[model samples]
Target chain A: MARTFEFHGGVYPPERKQRSQGPVRHAMLPGRVVLHLDQHAGRPAFATVAVGDSVKVGTPIARCDGMISAALHASISGQVTQVDRHTITIDSDGLDAWQRLTPLEWRTASAEERLTRLEHSGVVGLGGAGFPTHIKARVSERQRIDTLVVNAAECEPYITVDDLTLRQYTSDVLEGAQLIASLCGAKQIVVGIEDNKPEAISALRQAMAESQPLSVTVSVIATRYPSGGERQLIKTLLDRDVPDKGLPADIGVLCQNPGTLLAALRSVRDGEPLVERLVTLTGEAIADPGNRWVRIGTPMAALLDEAGLNRAALHQLIEGGPMMGTPLADLEGVVTKTTNCLIAATRKELPPAPPESPCIRCGACEEACPANLLPQQLHWYARAKDDAKLAHYRLFDCIECNACSYVCPSHIPLVADYRHAKTRLRHQQLETAKAEHAKHRFEWRQARLDREEAEKQARRQARLARQSTQQTDSQGASPQADLRSLRIAQTAAKAAVRKAEKNLARAAQQDPQQSHDDLETQLATAKENLQAAEARLAEARSAGEPQETP
Target chain B: MSDAFSIISLLSAVAVLTALGVGFGALLGAVSERFKGDESSLVEQIDTLLPQTQCGQCGYPGCRPYAEAINQGDAINKCPPGGDATITALADLLGRTPEPLDGEAPSEDLVAFIREDECIGCTKCIQACPVDAIIGAAKQMHTVIEDECTGCDLCLEPCPVDCIDMLPRSTPLAQWQPVTYPHQMIASDRRASMEMPHGTHL
Candidate 1:
């Protein structure tokens, strides 16, 4: 455990961790809070509470939808104000009354029971990974888990929540670690903390002494940037390499963040779900800065206001560490399970990034990249949108730690370029899939219509053939049907001739001297017309088109 | 005796030369047959370049027919629904110089919207549509299936009531994100930010 393995390139930014000076304070309750549904690293939860519904603290407002999702709870007693696609807003009543999840006795319960409670309580990795704890703690029978590594390395600058949490609840963290170890079925349990945090280390030691039966060991490694990364910490403490693109458990190791451990212990020990978390509120613009146990849905504005921050002096508001935090687009955004730190930086404290200059083909970025990827070449390919080349160089393998951006002499935002390229690539892939789907649907519909049309045309042709064959008898039937039709025609013809003769006679009587010869001609023409019709019927019968008569 | 020997050798040499010529000619013919690719694959390549809208703005019946014509050396700039991008893609595929779209490529995306009130139940449009995207019965009001409609313009002429109109389609809300313009950093902010503590910037 003494021999530490070194990872590749990293930067030594000033560890401004003075925010851990004061005792952990409770943040003032916010009047309103906005909780994002997509707090975890996977699919967002499905909303279980509708607008205008009253919810109490720890009430499940959104349940986990898919295998990778985590359930969301109401952080305070409130009325649901708004529910949008991305977020759920609640107006708090300022009441601290608790209605919690049913807790489980972890000491006596089986691992399955413990896991169910942990998942139902909505406990996730609080080290900013936001991975569901239950999923991580599960040890599949495929791999043998040997060690449970407690990650207490608060390596990022300006984040002290983990440090403070370990100091206050070391015993609880130890118990949580034991619970996770039991679940993972690991024999050896160890805590990996950076040597820089002597207070947290001693506090852990004190707790380990009290909990002798648990028998946990603590390993202290030299503090380094990104050493807090689960992979780096495992490599440093255990000298084991997690397979590329694989988890620590692949190599018989499971790493737990101290905050996650404490949360797990609380979920199991008490009948309380995870509705609040310790967030470090610090930066130059704040009047007072320290770590505080803030309710999960409390808005960043409310917390900053409590820290006596001057918004006018704010050059940038960042969420998480200085190196890897997101620039806040909305200061009113509420905290979630993964919130570890808030940096309210002034222009002087954390200056705005300068406009990028030409790359100058500098190799400093290469030396500073811990993942050892060629950042300059990647940046070029990304700008050119040469996705094929970028993929060939394994662009997705980038951890996006921003060390390359920190070391870039040109002040280029390397990580942002990578993010933009990745987004564009994803969009392109999605568009291609959509186009293929559309093409298939269009082609299938056309084929179906054409087949139907062809079938209909064939049917029409067949009917025409039949009708032409039966031209003499339109019914196209037997000899009896034809003879009967002929008889009807003959009778109609005779009736017509009789009626015409009668009319002629009446006309001659009415005007005695007027055209007696004309009346005679009209009756003669009717008799001749009937003879012509009979001849035509005989001619059609002789043509052999169809025959009903013998 | 020597003259007779010379005549026999000359006859043998000529026979060998004739046999060699016929055998090599046969080998070359076989090679040609073996290497000649199916010309229909070229048609397939051209068809793949088309957007498959089946809109027939290209003066052909469908994308497949247009692709065949292009394979037979037809102009590649006739499609408007496929537009300029399609023209360029076809040119690239065929190794031709990229030309401007013939006539005018529709500058805006269009969707066939049916004005239900003005629809006369003639069903002429339903018969005219190449994609069968219109749904109706004889003497019943017809509606366009917007998702499947290719906006071919053939339906417009047959509509007795002229109820079908091609309107510019709006972008879907799900696909929208805040536009991040590159290289738009403010000068003052840029100046203030260059105050790096070390030679390397954070």
Candidate 2:
């Protein structure tokens, strides 16, 4: 028995995992599948196929967008029906045809080749995070990893997918772990699981004995809720705390989910992409409560119907365990890589939460928190929307395990508040970054405008100086004097024309019949004189000689 | 003999006091010179707090000018684009009381959109944009770089053909956030009422 360490705070909820204890079964193929572009944690994959394109199972439908993203493959042999911004829907033709890459010998293959194969396989962390697995494995380039931790704790009650995977494919899981260990150059591998899963523990132990060359050990700890969390499991197994806002890699450790390891093995050995995963369907409202190999993009309604769902008794449908699962409002929503367990809970089995009351400062939540966070304080800060205080309390360290909420005497939704606060903090950080970018661009634009203005002013000053110097050298009168005389002549002509027009207007108003013709003649003569003076000025200017005011 | 002794003591006291005053004054002047703060950096800090929308809604030419004005005792609540958030941040940095926004706040985040076919190859918007987010040359069709655009709306009036539209920024589906508790409850309630009939088919 490998010794284990204890973490801060944990709660032992009713381990209602007996319902889904049977062997895993393959589910029937659906008539249609809707694959969302963004099933992983990073950038969404860009679609490589159009609406009318024909595709087989394992066909590369979408390519990875960036380093942190995962590629997506078609789960069913079908024709693409709709290609929208969010999802790509395919209608199956009822054939299980496949398009696969040639499998590589991982032992003989270089690390880069194995990584490329993993990238092409679209394997992600099936432990509900859906983080791309290849990026996680590539940590060996920058850091020297010493241990690989296989997370098979399966601590969340009523979710038996990992347990069943370990029981059925123990060697495959162990071999996959070895493959990752070799890739990351880790000398030791540890499988951290709960003692309640005796079957899985025994299977892992038997496999460990058979794999003599690989250094692998099974560490079975007491079953506790949220012990499956990456940080908690690492803490329990190695007594090492992942630094705040740091990753397992920072501590020279790499933690990979069992399902993700199995998927990577299949991708490198069988030339298969991640087309399906083991899903646990169990609740009071389910007639056949067990695990099944459900294809990605299978609709919730179809999967539930296959499990013999009790529609009238089903009050709420959750996508994960009852502790930290999200309730499903749309039955038509399809399952993605992160959908691990489905719980069609009845009203009595999982009743709606009561309305929240003010906190009594009982400190039960603090005692039950697995991450050692002060849930009551976080709740107050979240309610007040005090982002600074929430950050000061280290709100980002919260894993949203719902242990605190479960043990709260007042029935406070502590995890929900923490999730909201975390999202708001992330949003605030993004806004600040954007503001900084905008400030940079604004400053650059201002500097450019100032430079342009300075250049224009310099050019104008140079032209004035050059003109003055040219006039002094070539002519007796400077251009400044010439310009002054021209301005005086033009003003005098404009005043004479105005006087003539006013006189004509006055004569017309007094006695229009007698004096209108005489004033009109005077006005015409003044206009002619003005035109003659402007023509002389223009001729002199065009001749490049100074013009005298008339 | 008593008068001579008293005069000598008074003169000695005056000389000692003058020496102490001169020495302390020299020390104070050196310390003040060495520790003098940069005045422009204060403006830079204030400018960082203000949103760089450059919308001219704050009655200044840009965010930097407004930041300078704020440092020069101008009211901090006049920015509509930065709105209350900027005011609170400025108050925190300047150690002043936060005030309510002085003008109408923008109803939503807006990005400028140009109807391309109606652009008529005019470059008016390109010149009007403060951040140079719009790309075009004279007598060439202009377009807004959506990511670079700060949504200042300074280019709206510059369009000759009235082709520019200030539309609310559209969030991509990938960026859509999950609904929090209160909103989630409301959504479930509405779903229950509407999906009851659909449930029967199952």
Candidate 3:
């Protein structure tokens, strides 16, 4: 038995995963599937198929738009019913056909080839984050990764999809882990499983013994809620703290969920895109509580109904687990790449939170925080909308595990406040960046205008100087020359006025109904110029210079 | 003979004190010249906090001019496009109390739209635009680059045919952010119940 390490504060939530334990069952095909383009964390994928097009299972419906995004494939043979900005709806034809990529020999394939396969297969972190796996694996290019931590903790209560995945396909999971380790040049693999899942641990251990290619070790950690978190698991397995606002790769360690590893394996070895995943359907309101292999884009209501959901007894329908799951207000919501578990909990089973009260200033919340954050202070600052104070307190480090909210004596939703504050802070940062960009553009435009103005002024000065030199050469230094030039300028201004008046008249006659405002303004400016020219000529004449009409 | 010696000693002491005063004054002048703070950089710092709309609602020609005026003890609440946020930022930077906005705050961000068919091709709006967001030639239909438009509304008055319309900016679906936490459930549920074409429940 390998010695394990301890993380910071954590709580022991009841492990209600026993009810969901069984052989994984294949869910019925959904009549219609709604696939969101932005199922992954980064930029949304671009739709490749159009409406009225037919698609077989595993057919590419959307292609990755950027390096951080993942491709999307059809989960069932279907006709594209609608293609919109956010999602693509496909109506199944009940064929359950296939269109798959070419499988690759993971051991013999080059690292680049295996990575490309992973990128094209739409594999993401199935532990609920939905981060594109290829991007995470590509971190090896910048940093030398030494350890690959296989997270099998499944620490959240009522979530047994990972456990069931390990029990059913233990060797496949290990093989996926080894493939990723080789891809990242990692020398050792560490499987971190909480002691609560004895079956999963035994299966993992037996699979490791059967085919031991790389150095593998199983670290059975104590059962604790949220121990499955990436940061927490890494701390327990390797005792390495992922730095503030940094990734696991920064410390030469990469943590991957077991389900995500299996998906990667299926994509490379079986040439199958990530179309289906095992989802845990449990809670007291469910008649048949067990894990089922659900297709992506299946409607939540249909899956719950198939699991014998008692609507009358169901108080709330959570999309993940009790500790971190989001409450589903609408049953029509469809599953995506991140959907892992659906808990149709009864009112008594998961009671509604009591009304919030003023904080008693007790240290219970601080003690329960897994990230060692001061929830009480954070709650106050978040409510006050004090961004500076929240930043100073390292608000971004919060994993939003709801541990503080669970232990709050005042029943305050600390995690909710923190989430709101984080969103606001992020929005503020984006706005500041935009403001800075606009300033730069404005300044650049100003500088260009100034330079153009200076050039024009310089050109006008040179023209004036050249004209004066020509005048000095043509006419001897005499007052009559100045008078003659003034008279010439007056005549030219008079001609300009005549031309402006004639053009304005023509424009008015050409379009009787059109407003001739621009033409009128031009004529008015020309008249003003003629008046100034006449004034200058009169002044020259009064100066006693001979006025010669040219 | 003793009185004559005292007068000579007093004159020598006065000469030494004058030399010391001049020497210390020269050193102090050199130090001040070498370590003088850059005043324009202060103006630059203030300008960064402004929204850079260049709308001239602050009685200045542009954001930089307003930043200069603020550096010279001008009020920090005249920017309507920046609104109270800019005022608060300026106040924080200058260590002064934030004042209420001097002018009516813009209700929402707006971008100018040219009714292409109605445009007379005067190019007045193009010239009036401070950010050069509008692109066109003389006697050619002008259009606003929505992304670069600051929504300053400076071109509205210069448009001779009244073809320019200031409309609320529309956010693309890709840029739309989902509300988090407590309100997320209700907002997403409402969106689903309405059966909006885009059925993303993130």
Which candidate leads the pack in DockQ?
Answer: 1
Interface RMSD of each: 5.9, 8.3, 8.8
lDDT of 2 by residue, A1-550 (tens): 8889999899888888999999999999999999999999888999999999999999999999866899999999989999987789999999989998898888889999999999999999999999998888888987899999999998888899999999999999998998899999899999999999999999998989876356899999989988999999999999999999888998999999899999999999899999999999999999998999988999999999999999999998888887777778767778899999998988877776654456899998888787888889999999789988898888988887888878776666677777777777777776776777676566556545654554454455445546865766535243332545755776787788799899878877754324354355456556655655555455335333432332
Residue-wise lDDT of candidate 3 within B50-112, one digit each (tens)? 988888888898899999999999999999988888888888889999999988998998888
Instruction: State the lDDT of candidate 2 residue by residue for B42-152, as single tens digits.
Output: 999998788788889988899989999999999999999888888988999999999999989898989999888788877888888987789977777888888778899
Write candidate 1's Cα lDDT for A184-283 as tens digits.
8888778888888889888987888766345788888888777887777888788888777677878999888988998999988796888999999999
Screening candidate 3 with a backbone cut-off below 3 angstroms (N, C-alpha, C), the clashing residue pairs are none
Off by over 4 Å in 2: A450-550, B1-18, B97-101, B174-202
Q: lDDT for model 1, on a 0 to 1 scale?
A: 0.78
Query: Which segments of model 1 are wrong by more than 4 Å?
Result: A107-119, A133-151, A177-192, A205-219, A230-256, A268-271, A450-550, B1-56, B59-96, B103-178, B182-202
Query: Considering DockQ, which of the candidate structures 1 and 3 is the better prediction for this target?
Result: 1
lDDT of 3 at A495: 96
**All candidates: DockQ:** 0.17, 0.16, 0.16
TM-scores for all candidates: the values are 0.74, 0.83, 0.82
**Local distance difference test, per candidate?**
0.78, 0.83, 0.84
Which residue segments of model 3 deviate by more than 4 Å? A454-550, B1-29, B96-100, B136-141, B171-202
